[model samples]
Target: MKFSTNELLPLVSRLDQLLRTAEIGDYPGAFNGLQIENQGVVSRIVAAVDACEAVILQAAREPGTLLLVHHGLFWSGAQPIKGILYRKLKAALDGDLALYSSHLPLDLHPSLGNNVLLAKSLGLTGLKPSLELKGQSVGVMGKIKPMKREKFEALLCKSVGGRVHLAPGGPETIASVLVVTGGAGGEVARAADLKVDAFVTGEGPHWSFTAAEELGLNLFYGGHYATEVFGVKALARWLSEGTGLPWSFLDHPSGL
Candidate 1:
């Protein structure tokens, strides 16, 4: 089954409003809405974290496929569209693959966002928006039944499906957590200021470790890629259910 871009506009528009794609501020490169257009129609949807060459080629394999991503192309800003960039664009144009990206918007989405999903995966309650970035709350803070630090770390490791680096700076028992998926480790000071028992985020700089220790905040680094897969997957599933258009997630992990 195929759907025209016009038919999909309402759904996409609804998402833009729900996610505040236009109102919310994002990095200039985020270019949050539809980035690439196809030949006016779509047959299947492919969701992935980054719009890298491999993922673009994969989506291109299926003509009229809309590639949904968190980090879209053009991160490097205005440069000659040659080499890898040229190849990616060529593949999409040749194969009729459309592309759409949502960065901060997807991260802060109330239900189908990375931060909220990650918090939910760890069974956190009393979830509330936190961590302002460009006047938008891009992180979530929530309460967890107080548990031993080790037990909480174990649960976090399980949630992200990989190794977790823990800075055991907080109390032996953890009762609350702040989640900001993807490279928010630099926000250790901000999380500490929030006074949450712990802070969960993707990779951070080396100093963040000592800072967490100094600030007495439990910090968990759960790999940027691993923690961010939630938004795209959830968005894809929601779209499929709402529009009856089949979709698939392209697993391309960047072990950071």
Candidate 2:
């Protein structure tokens, strides 16, 4: 089914509504909206985790690809279209693609959102909003019945469809795990302060591993794109259900 840009805007607006209801993001990342317009009409939709240079190149292949992403372009200062930046811009413009992005807005959605999905996958119960970030509660921190760290990592791997990179710390049996999807490893210090049994997120810097060891906290690195793919896929399913739009998820993997 084809939808004009105007027709699809409502469907897209519903997506934003769901995200607003779901997200728990703080103010660190900004400008989570339609970053670019390529075509007046949108026929095929592509949902991915990031709007990076490589993903941009991939989207360029489809003429008028309406790329929906968890991470939007131009989050930082605007730079001149030169070098790699030039390539990314040129590809999107040349493809006549429109880019729509939702960051923290996508993470905390109740149903069909990253945090909720992840939490449910791990059998987390009584999940409710706990922490706030960037004037918005973008992350979900809740209680879960104690489980083994290995079992928790296995669930993460199965849910995200990736190999688990686990830095096992603390006890074999964990009572509560703190989960922040999509590169929230930098929050390790905060998780440590909370003294959770295990902390799970996507990607980690050099220091995070050390800190996890020092603090005796279990750490799971489940690839950034892999972990975040849940939200967009859920959003796409939601759009399909709500608007009857034939949406497709562009299964792109970033082995980061």
Candidate 3:
């Protein structure tokens, strides 16, 4: 099956009010939708967590493919088209591969978002939105079956498919956990204020270490790259279902 590359715009527009890419202040580099344009047609979709050089090079092998990613090509923002960045652009241009990104948008989407999937993976019940930013809740908070912190951390590690960083500050028995996937360790203090027993995120600053201990909130760091893969996979799958176009995920873990 194939779809016009333009079709994705209308399909994803329904999510504008929900993802709020325009309103949410993400890293200036996360330019969101359609970072690169293709030759107006897409027969295959490749979803990945980042648009790193390796992923770009790989996608270039499959000409005219559309690559859907979370992290995009502008971390350094715009620069003279030279060096490695030049190579990435040249590869996409050569391959006719389009790149589309969704950062906070992917994180907060209700049906196919990162936070919701992670929360569901942990068997959280009565999940409610939390960690509001830019007038949107990008995370979920909810009750987990009461259990030891060690056990809950183990479950989280399984859910994220990576080893987890646990700062044991709260009680041994976890009553609730709040999930904000990817670089949200700093939110532990806020999670503490909400009376949750545990907080889960990808990575955080070193200062967050002190905050978690001081606030007595169980902090779990489930590698930033690992936690965020959920959204891209979910999104590409949805597009496949809707368009009948084959979709694949290019897994390249940063191991951060």
Candidate 4:
């Protein structure tokens, strides 16, 4: 089923308001909302984590498709639109592929956001927002049955469907699990204040390891790309349900 971009615009706009993308702070490259305009007709919607060269080129192959992604192109600010970047743009435009990106907004969404989805996936109930970033609560804090750290780590691995890296930095009996999917290891200390026993996120830098230990927070480094898949899939499902357009996920994990 084909759907017009105009029909999807209101939904997208409502999502912007719901996510407070404009009110919230994000990278300039985030450029939330519609980054690429197509021929007003979108037949199939493809959801992915990033719009890298490979994903863009793949989208170009399927002309007239809308590529909904979490991290859109242009993270590095403006360039002359030449070389590989130019080819990316040309491929997208020439293929009539439209791109829409959501960064912090997607991460912080209450219902369909990545944090909430990740938390729910872990069977976490009674969730509360935590770890505010850029004036938004992109991280989630929740309770469990107070299992051992090892068991909790195993459950978390099951939740994200990826191997989890544990620092074993905090207490053995973990009562709470805080999740901020995607490269949030830098904020390990932030979890300390939330009173959670463990912190779950995508990948983080090396310093975060010692920091997690010093901060006495259990750190679980789930793959960044793996943890971030929730939001795009949720948004795409919502869009497909609302618009009657078929959708599929282009899951190309970076495995970071």
Best by TM-score: 1
Ranking by lDDT: 1, 3, 4, 2
lDDT, candidate 2, 30-123, per-residue tens? 6676777765666667788878888888777877567888887676666677887777778889988888888777787778768778877777
lDDT of 1: 0.88
- Backbone clashes, candidate 2: 10
lDDT of 4 by residue, 2-93 (tens): 33443446656755776677777786555787887777677778899998888988877886688889988767666687898787888889
Per-residue lDDT for 105 in model 1?
88
Q: Model 3: clashing residue pairs? A: none
lDDT value, candidate 2, whole model: 0.74
Highest-lDDT candidate? 1
Which residue segments of model 4 deviate by more than 4 Å?
Answer: 1-11
Candidate 2 TM-score, true structure as reference: 0.85
- Candidate 3 C-alpha RMSD relative to the actual structure: 2.4
Per-residue CA lDDT of candidate 1, range 38-106, in tens?
Answer: 876767878999999989998999887878899998665677988988999999999999898999989
Provide TM-scores for the models.
0.95, 0.85, 0.92, 0.93
Q: Which regions of candidate 3 fall more than 4 Å away from where they truly are?
A: 1-20, 75-77
TM-score ranking from best candidate downward? 1, 4, 3, 2
Full-model lDDT for every candidate: 0.88, 0.74, 0.84, 0.83
